[model samples]
Target: MSDYCGGCRYDPKQRVGDHACPYTAGYWSFLARNETEFSGNHRMRQPMQGLHRLTDLDALVDQEKARGSIAP
Candidate 1:
């Protein structure tokens, strides 16, 4: 999953994107769902570091908001 050089559309390296991997999907959901309770821990900070690299962060947040509206 580390390599994006293959034909796989999803990139496990990214935090959020159309080509983001399953880990990102779950990670984003966890973060969004627990935004208030989430803290700046070393473990969380490690993976979240890459989130700053995403150019379309707004779009990713929008996607989370939309998902929240549809969720029960």
Candidate 2:
């Protein structure tokens, strides 16, 4: 781990749950929120497919929405 992540509570590899990194959650949230807009783009094909594979996607979306503008 990098020195910057030594004391951080968030996990960069996690996208859900209490210890999820806000940035990671935010990324998936953005993709979920704009799936239609990005669906036709070739570059987005892989990520969009990956989004569909996330079993906890709905939960992640709800969590991020509940978090709103609050900082984690």
Q: Write the per-residue lDDT of candidate 1 for residues 1-72, one digit (tens) a residue.
A: 565547867786764666766556556655655544555676667546555565766666666556563253
Candidate 2 residue 31 Cα shift, in angstroms, is: 0.3
TM-score of 1: 0.43
Residue 33 error, candidate 1, Å:
6.1
lDDT of 1 at 1: 55
* Model 2 residue 8 distance off true place after TM-score fit, in angstroms: 1.4
Q: TM-scores for all candidates?
A: 0.43, 0.84
lDDT of 2 at 62: 88
Each model's lDDT: 0.59, 0.88
Cα lDDT for residue 8, candidate 1:
69
Q: How would you encode candidate 2's per-residue C-alpha lDDT over 3-43 as one tens digit per residue?
A: 66668899978888899989889999889989999999999
